[model samples]
Target: MEFNSLGVLMIITIIILILFIMMKKIKNNDSDTSKKLFTAFEERMGLTCDVIDLKEEIYGIGLDRSSNTIIYLNFVNGVEQCIGLSEFKGVYVHRVEQNKRSFGKSKEITEFVFIKLLPKSDLAGQISLELFNHKWYPFSMEELELINKWKRIIEENLS
Candidate 1:
């Protein structure tokens, strides 16, 4: 079998194209799953709310203006968990920082914003929600603001 430079280039290009298409398909599937989960949540809540953040099959945050509740939907290992909170023990925000050094390079600092849900019941453990950037980077200011606003609404309703 004789292969020329052009033939090798063509093969590489075809492989790249196929990989790209496959990635797009996978992303579309995740988006579809997210939409379905959101719809189900909305139906159960019986009120329309805007989705604040969706992390594919991981979790989602929504705010119901009519009921003044924060809807948290989480999917883990094929199990779906939903929490509708009009009242809670507390809402807390904190920052996490980590420093790491790799192969003689200077230390790198990574920060994350963690929004925690403290349920009133002793049976339920605290739940932490993380905010990320559009590119899936950690700690997004917009998400933080949205979460804070929802927390305030919930607190006011409880009072």
Candidate 2:
């Protein structure tokens, strides 16, 4: 009993489809996992920094959260501005939307997309886009420093 060409092709096609679906799921999960980790970082860091989540209410209450828009906070000077956290609530949310198209649907493949307003002047003098996941989009050093700083804050505060 030899294997038929159609049978072989069918097996190959099914395998490919399964693999593709699995890959998509994995990718989606990875990004969400990374976001989860980051979200924890945000919460642990407290209300000090603006937890801007585009998926949520991009437009926030101007009175406490942001006077103009929180998305613009990715400034060259970093997340820490003289604005102060206590006096400011925030215009951000808990979940941000995914703009990139990919295979996985529910995967979180390492928080890929990020935006920055400028470079961190104090840290290394200049911010490189690679401070991000080497994504095609440019991410300012200031944003990276803020993320790192918050991650550190979570480790120090929670741990």
Candidate 3:
């Protein structure tokens, strides 16, 4: 009986070790993707990123302080957009939420979130960087915080 218990403990330890290693590898892969995307973006745009946020695997945002340029990239879809701070008249956090009632409880569900950049000129189109969408990704508080952070950063640079 004691021998069987000891063997079980060993098995559990090994399983835990394997899980830890797998988690580490997954983290490393994310870092690698961010690095690659940053490098490619910098090279293609010919601008160095002074700050970058890549918490979301599907999307990334970067800023070039010297030139006051903000770049938004969609990694999975291969979509990229960049704009100068001077061109935008307003920066806003656009959030779409719906109230749902279930089980005698009310809850608000976020359907979409974005950082919208309104251009100064009416003819020029406004730009929106996607942070989260209920259809594609689950809502996250971190994304909310990130969108707010970037809004502040862009507003500061605009000033």
Per TM-score, the best of the predicted structures is: 3
Each prediction's number of clashing residue pairs:
0, 16, 0
Candidate 3 global TM-score: 0.89
Against the true structure, candidate 2 reaches a TM-score of 0.37
Q: Give lDDT tens digits, candidate 1, residues 1-159.
A: 357888999999999999999999998899789878877877876867754567676667676656666666655434343456644677777566666768878754436555677888889888766543223445455656766775665555553
Q: TM-score, each model?
A: 0.62, 0.37, 0.89
- What tens digits encode model 3's per-residue C-alpha lDDT throughout 1-159? 999999999999999999999999998898788778866977799889889887546777899998899888887777788778999889998889999999999999999888888989999988888778787778887777778899899999984
For candidate 2, lDDT tens digit of each residue in 58-140? 11111114322222222222332222223222211122235565675563334443322232233422211112332334445
Query: Weakest 10 consecutive residues, lDDT, candidate 3?
Result: 52-61
Between candidates 2 and 3, the one scoring higher on lDDT is: 3
lDDT value for model 2: 0.36
Ranking of candidates on lDDT, top first = 3, 1, 2
The per-model lDDT (C-alpha) reads 0.66, 0.36, 0.85
